[model samples]
Target: MRSNVLGSAADFRRGGHSSRRPLDSHLAQLFMRDLRADAPPQLPIFRSRLQGELLARLLLGPDREHTMLDLAVMLRTDLGSVVREVDRLARAGLLTLRRTAAGRLASRDTATPLHEPLAQLVMHTFGPKAVVAEEFGALPGAAEIHLFGAWAERYSGVAGEPPGDVEVLVVGAVDPGAAFDAAQESAARLGLPVHPVVRTVGEWRDDTDPFLRQIRACSLVRAR
Candidate 1:
């Protein structure tokens, strides 16, 4: 089903874009089809990271109808802690809170129509090179996916624009060839770029100057 849709979309992209971004219009729509079903994937579950994630979510817009106490329960934290954070977040201008009918402290949805800004941000901040490298770090043994090259930058966004682009580096033992061809076909259709780096465990360990490092200049050092 997906393949057919993608193929049709690609057929429509004869020359609508510069480079390979023509598929973006359709693909972006497809990817966004169910994005808001549950926005939890965007949050950090770690106790320490929760505050920042919540704050980011507010900046990105979470339901403002709910109060901070409701949010505290959702966050599984004490109401007092949520209140403190709410105070801090409000001061930062990322969120606004109000008392709900249930007497809970809820956050105001200050988030703009975010998908566009977020997509652009993903691209602008990561750049094709660093985005790919970081992707490999998460995927492990991801060197083969590099074949996508410039297309990777297409999805990941140009080094600093952060809009209309998203870079993803998939490592692990996934088949690089299959992934590349799939991405190529998809890129031709949806126009999103996915730069992958797939390698064997041996390849990653065999050389100190890993392929990922070849693009080292592009990335911020991964947090240990």
Candidate 2:
């Protein structure tokens, strides 16, 4: 089902618009308002990192549901902010809210025509942060993980073609083999190539290294 949605999104982007419907006027206006606000460097499509992370989690896996507390923990945000964003998205018709026995649960509104395209956009843009964080955060001796290169450039609002792959920098004592395995897993989950370059903490801190210096000059989205 996930693959189908992603494939459909790809096809939708390739002139497969006959079946696509326009967004509701009210929803469009709401989205426009959100977009007009200052966006985060990690995912410039949305006004804030919280918004991007929230939408990416809900939309990318529409079948799953999460409570406000669950979302807060997963997103590393406050409960108040999660509640506000959930309310806003729910009002926009992008998410559905319901009270369960445990608590209020939020999930993607699959009924919305915007689901597919929006999910695709999230998958390509903000997806790397979430996916990479999950995959590499637990690596032994990994002190810091960052995303750089084409994907980082686009995410930082540099206009260009969509990134074909994700570039990652792992700084710590983690084994190179472990980093490679994590990269492979992340690539599989994202449907894009993930290239991870492991550097020791000392190497990353060195300012004289041309490669490290160049990476520092560009946008680097921290994953862990």
Give the number of the best model, judged by TM-score. Answer: 2
Q: TM-scores of the models, in the given order?
A: 0.31, 0.49
Candidate 1 residue spans exceeding 4 A from truth: 1-51, 61-79, 91-93, 108-138, 143-224
Candidate with best lDDT: 2
The sequence of per-residue lDDT tens digits that candidate 1 reaches over residues 110-169 is 364543554334233323333334334343334443423333434434443322333344
What is each predicted model's overall lDDT from 0 to 1? 0.43, 0.78
Q: Could you tell me which residue pairs clash in candidate 2?
A: none
Report how far off residue 31 is in candidate 2 (Å): 32
Q: Write one digit per residue (lDDT tens) for candidate 2, span 36-143.
A: 445667666475767887887677532668899988877776676688679877877899999978989998898999886787788666698778988999899999
